[model samples]
Target: MLSAVPRFAKIAAVVVLAAAASLATFDIADARRAGSSGFGSRGMRTFDTPAITRTAPTQAAPIDRTMTPRPQQQPAAQPPLGAQQRPGFFGGFGGSMIGGLIAGGLLGMMLGHGFGGGFGFLGLLLQIGLIMLAISFAMRFFANRQRTQYAGPGASYNNSAMNNANASPRPSFSIPSIGGGTAASQKARQANDEIGLQQADLDRFEHLLTEIQSAYGAEDYATLRRLTTPEAMSYLAEEFGENATHGVRNSVSDVRLLQGDIAEAWREGDSEYATLAMRYSSIDAVVDRATGKLVDGDDRNPSETTELWTFVRKPGSDWVLSAIQGTGTH
Candidate 1:
């Protein structure tokens, strides 16, 4: 009974350690950024993946929270009747045999008889290792066979052509010249040809970047409502409410646009939408509401952030922020 107690304690310790490791693996740090993932509407393009650009090469997180209903994907065509089906990793006669072996081994271990009814924990481990080694060998063999089959006459030429096609140059946008009208005009012209964005538009975007940050930090609802769309304002308001609940306030200031480029620009009916990837530095932090003591982030030093901000406007109307997507940066 004393020996059993020690064994049970050891098992409990291992389980606790495993649970801790699992929790640590899935832990994510929360930031005070507008929207960490994609949200809000982007007109008809809400469900479509945005074009990859120089600024944000990785795929932006999909619009998880939006008014737009996603189009249902077409079901894949069924294979022809009686056609031989390709066996999956754990499918068909071979897979069943392997699965049975594994299950039998596990049952043996549970029953204190070990794998194939003899060697105990060490035997179980050895069986698992051998099974894994067999799987690895099988996968490699199949991979090599497929490679050899595809390595026919014009394979090199086909591969070279594919590489060349994939290597097509990405469109480049000129950085807007701050405080210089002439330079801004030239640079804006050099921006994405499809968008037809002007120097004034780029200026507005930069201005809003600073303005919105300041307003959010100050908890100025009026300013936030004026600068952002109704949908966006609601999100900001929600964040503010959450902060108030937590007894903390997000303090943001000293915002400076480091680099920016238009990822995409398109007109949807009466409204025009432009998604810009902007990298900026700001002294963004959280402070205790009551004590005014810093809770998170550096108050003295500014931190850089890269994000995709989508702005919308109609004819003769000023641009307003519609959506903000983080580039997976804190």
Candidate 2:
């Protein structure tokens, strides 16, 4: 029995040694993902969604025709020519003032009542002052004529551009636009969308965001197909295929949404699209298919990213990821 025990111990030791050697010899690839699969931005965009009708429209956009109210244009600004627009004093006060000054100067020169005699330079000044006084009287007389000529009711100023300032501030809140005007009209819309996003909607989207990332990392194409649109799935598949060709796979874990905001939400026909800006963190790592060694990404470290994701859904249907975009698109 003692001898058999020694033999058994030797066998176990050899097995352990072989296992360690195999582990040491196993190939380890490099990790490439920075703790995540990377940011997505495939679908439409925010802030400038104008002209792109296939995607959801921005809210409060004076441009896109949404359900929200069109923001009224700002009050017409007084043109730069406000002073010019007002009617001048009758008979041209300016013209009379200049004419009288010049005539008096000429008369003074001819009469030798100023610089050439009497008051000298001072006399010239007095003569000009008298001319100005005469001009004032003339101005008053003409002003009276103007007042009488236009006497009807109270003084009324009519401005042609009473309602024409190039453009006004657009509401960024959830107001819908009036109608689908020309696509170009929506370009200069306000910077914000009237995103009436509900808490429920956010929560659902957050969940979907995390799930989709996890599924993609797992190479679970079926789940990806179900959660994303066919177009998105195709892109994802291409990405996966490329990764596979390189003998790499991303392992995503611990996905959390740091923050999220809606760029816009609107119905395009029967389908609704909501473009969201999401700041999220995740632990991701790329592994070598042959060695199960990290090829990229830090599995222990968290990566923070801000991405714009657009989700689309038909009425009475579930929302699926349609596109990914850069952050702050709105």
The lDDT leader among the candidates is 1
TM-score of each: 0.69, 0.44
Q: For candidate 2, give the lDDT of residue 208.
A: 93
Give the per-residue lDDT of model 1 (tens digit) for 225-305: 999989888888988999999999999999988767776788888899988777788999999999989999988999988
The backbone clash count of each candidate, in order, is 0, 25
Candidate 2: misplaced stretches above 4 Å?
1-195, 327-330
Tell me how candidate 2 scores on lDDT.
Answer: 0.56
Q: What is the lDDT of residue 13 in candidate 2?
A: 34
Local error of candidate 2 at residue 129 (angstroms): 78
Each model's lDDT comes to 0.72, 0.56
User: Any idea what lDDT model 1 has?
Assistant: 0.72
